[model samples]
Target: MNAASLLHLLQFASPALPIGGYSYSQGLEAAIEEGLVTDADSARAWIVCYLDEVVARWDAPVLWRLMSAFAAHDAGTIAQWGGCFLASRDTAELRAESVQMGYSLSRLIAELGVADTRALGEDVTLPLAFACAVDGLAIPHEEALLAMVFAWVENQVLVCVKSVPLGQVAGQRLLLSLRPEIERAVELARRLPDDELSNWAPGLSMLSMRHEVQHGRLYRS
Candidate 1:
């Protein structure tokens, strides 16, 4: 709405934002290593499954609840949401990745002089802290959700570029192809019932767990 809110949303959503997002592959590297995502078609399918089942069904709804809690200034609810987010992470790498990025982003927001930043005092979960900071900064729910999903997609595409060795054009095209899916993810996120917030991407989670023990690794996760 306001210029500051718009700027905050853009800052949060930008692929170039310094949240250490590029360092983690979200288990895509393991998927690639296992030959599960060896080509453009496979990459697209893997990404679609991740978005539709894992993120849309699991992470997005938690983020929405975090945003709601932040908007309401409910510290207790926010803490509960953070616990839930942590529990949802099935692997050590996945858990560490989320917390690391969240800590970095929360520190970044504090340095940027966003008000009420201390609410995310220390060691907050990535999605919860992110949702809280942006919502605390007065960004509307729709804009915050859009930014969150956009960031998620951008990070995934970046992973695809490296794992699949896709050219920039190809990566952009793949990203373009995801617009419809992104819209659906956003819509599904908005309508998700509180009781149904669970990520069922067993393959993705297993890949992440395996990646932790992977030899000759190319990614942190």
Candidate 2:
């Protein structure tokens, strides 16, 4: 890809992008409280499961489809896929997180004049906003997916570091160890047919539901 596109993709995925990604753990905190994740090893396992199961099977593929829809300027397809994505959210908090992040990114995209998010309508989900921006910036599809996966992996690691009380070095090590799996997931996302795509992560979804009423939680979901 061209340097400008690469830079834009980096900026989109950066932790400092200020879309509130850092504030949400996507159920990691609930897992920690339940002792499903504790210390480096458990944290690594939890993140790996999320990557392989939820992301690889669901979010990444949906993102791939959304990016294609944006590139084609198919607003109808974008809305259809976006709605499907939102409906798949297992809990209220998870749905809110996606919408809130999407709204934030939509506003930022408007300010930068980088993408026309009107196609996504008012309730744009995070992947919809991201796919639109990537297409608008002319980021290549495979690279865009890689960047998205990397950003999520890094954020999950950061969540583990803070909540699991894992050392920075251990978190870094965990990130390194998961690189191969990340690459594998990206590939799976690229090749998986639409019919095969799924968001059937019952265990994780249950944790998210439990997190809704959990007192003194660190994450929104």
Candidate 3:
């Protein structure tokens, strides 16, 4: 945990990292449209459940495995995990969001003269590509997982602030409430076996599918 490695992890998780993360609400926008997340309380509640069920249960664990594979330099493992990760996305938009972000991050990594992970193929999903960057920095897996969880929480909070039309204070409050959950999420992901990880957000999938056809949408699903 030298200062330089810490800085690299922060920069890797920076919202300005240019992965187009702000563009996708991951179905929050559709939920807002349907009045499922009308106010600050509801918005906060929705995101809390989403963090525990969708992110902690699926994305973080997938990311954990990806980080493990990257650390071992196991390209086959990375590719296999990428397939499973995409399969977990219940909707087409969700799948595209992961792939597009993954591609953008991969190019950014190459541009930074990070390890030439170009051999990981054209479609290295976000978590895998992100793990490649974090592993390159020599950040430990646990620290990297925390960074991923924080970044996701921050991004989804912004999604709520914009879509739910909540004030900045409410969004900040929501983030504060979720801070302790990041450690819990990291712990949950660690204890999760690879065979047990699966995506199971039917409500989110329906919202995302609806978002594909929703009119006057402010964000992509």
Off by over 4 Å in 1: none
Rank by TM-score, highest first.
Answer: 2, 3, 1
Better of 1 and 3 by lDDT: 3
Q: Report the backbone clash tally of model 3.
A: 0
CA lDDT of 129 in candidate 3? 88
Each candidate's root-mean-square deviation in Å? 1.4, 0.8, 1.1
- lDDT of each residue in 68-165, candidate 3, tens digit only: 88888888988888888877777889889999999999889888887677677766789978988987778878888998889888888898888778
What is the lDDT for 215 in model 3? 99
lDDT (Cα, tens digit) per residue for candidate 1, span 1-221: 88988987887778788888889888999998898988778888888888888788878888888888887878998888788888888899998999998888888877877645676666677887688677767889887887788778888888889767888899999989999998999899889888877787777888898899999887899
Error of 1 at 13 (Å): 1.3
Clashes of each: 0, 1, 0
**TM-score of each predicted structure versus truth:** 0.94, 0.98, 0.96
lDDT (Cα) of model 2:
0.91
| Per-model lDDT | 0.83, 0.91, 0.85
Which 10 consecutive residues of model 1 have the lowest summed lDDT? 114-123
Return model 2's CA RMSD, one decimal.
Answer: 0.8
What is residue 22's positional error in candidate 1, in angstroms?
0.5
